[model samples]
Target: MALGPASVKNEGTKEFDFTARDFERVRSLIYRRAGIALADSKQEMVYSRLARRLRATGIRSFQQYLDQLESHADSPEWEAFTNALTTNLTAFFREAHHFPILAEHARKKGGPLTVWCSASSTGEEPYSIAITLCEAFNSLTPPVQIIATDIDTNVLNTAAHGVYPFERVEKLEPERLRKFFLKGRGEQEGLVRVRPELRQLITFKQLNLLEGGWPVQGPFDAIFCRNVMIYFDKPTQGKILSRFAPLMKPDALLFAGHSENFLYVSNAFKLRGKTVYELNQGGAPVRPANPGKLEKML
Candidate 1:
């Protein structure tokens, strides 16, 4: 999910000729493929990101590259194109306030906690959820299961490994850093790996919310969909929320990005707190409970 100002990279040395028609064609393709609505402000940014694809495939121009795509409906380049424009900006305990409420919700449930980090990027957000549950339950191996998912397979690959540079974790409180992560040593210095306990609590997968069917099964206690909806238009956001409503437990909470508000999108959810939503009583039709085994994920 892209945020804030559009990029201002110098366009003078661009290797490929990226025309307005090419840009519009790209906007249309990505919208239908991934439900992303590229703003006119993102033209410079689009050119910069997709240029690498042109280079990678040895295509000489944006027109030729897009032509290859229009010709082959199932080209692997579609995946690469979607990944290129997808922006993943996340940090551990990002939008930090959401964790405390999630912990308290788990406490009230009084059973094993199940969470879905629907936009987890590079493992940080879901790992943060795991750590919060561990602290709330006062054990590293608390009865918790987390499924971390993202549309970008590239980010999911990094997340599945549970590794990061030291800077990524340095701001975390010292005790949390010690308990939840293994700082690299010797040849691996300056890199950190999430403690295996935390890693085991999560299963990483690629999921497109717009896709017809989701592999996920739930009555999940919580769903963290922060920062993701901003990329989608109102209708796309509403459709995803409608799908999410059924998988959620009646009391389940939906944590959104600081910049997002779901109230207008669907009646299924109502704001419970700052950027947090819970099912509107009778606002959604839920699926039957199917509490599946977490071991299947491992």
Candidate 2:
């Protein structure tokens, strides 16, 4: 007789039972720890990644897997949790319009301007920032510093390596392709790496935006936190923005994802343009002192 779905069993009569409740538990745990809210639609993805862990550990059920994750003292499961949860989609100069504006800002500032590429997936955005700064201040006295960060350590490692496949860099202009990148050769052919001079300007680190006490020493001239807030809900988004404001210099430029709207969030930042806001430290227009009062104004 053939086994039915519920009757299927393997390895000491333990049957695999993946349930919605189990999915909710894992999803909530991820959110509580990392602030990444997984949609109910991602249940299959959650099951697939977590199921691997279950098989590896010889565990039979989701509850047992959770128990192991909670009690395991030295396991790297926490890192795996973060890696599975965070979205890492990015590309070289993905948002092309932002670069020219960044270059213009660097030129106008004309000093040691610091730029932070928060959520710099796969290193493209930060390197793009570095390249623009180099082009803008080619002969200028001081140099720009680019600090790139992401929550996913896996991607940060890749970003720090600075090597990418040739197709990944297809959008780059030929002149830029020649000037800023070293084309890989021999066993590494068809690959490209950011040249040492450009790579020297950027420092990559892992950062979780929701975590308290950011390691960054800021007052950065411009913060390119683009395309990152889409995963967070309104309250979390507002909280993150408020924390970021105090760390910026007065009149520092803050860039957000194209899809994000700060209207419902903190009013401490003044709208400069589409997806760009200026944090008012002293002379610029200030939002209400109370966050509740600011919400009314919004």
Q: TM-score winner among the candidates? A: 1
The regions of model 1 sitting more than 4 angstroms off are 1-12, 284-298
TM-score for every candidate vs. truth?
Answer: 0.90, 0.86
lDDT of 1: 0.85
Q: For candidate 2, write residues 1-298 as lDDT tens digits.
A: 1113433123443346776567667766776566676665565567667777778778889888777776874568877766776777888887687778878888888888888888998898888888888889883223887889888888989999999999998888998898888899999999999888877888898888988877788889999888877776566677788788877888688988777787656777877877888875553433333323111000
| Tens-digit per-residue lDDT, 80-192, candidate 1 | 99899898999998889988998898787766888999988788999999999999998999999899988899999999999899999899999999899998999999999
Query: What is the Cα-based TM-score of model 2?
Result: 0.86
Please give the lDDT score at residue 181 for candidate 1: 91
lDDT of all the models against the reference?
0.85, 0.76
Best by lDDT: 1
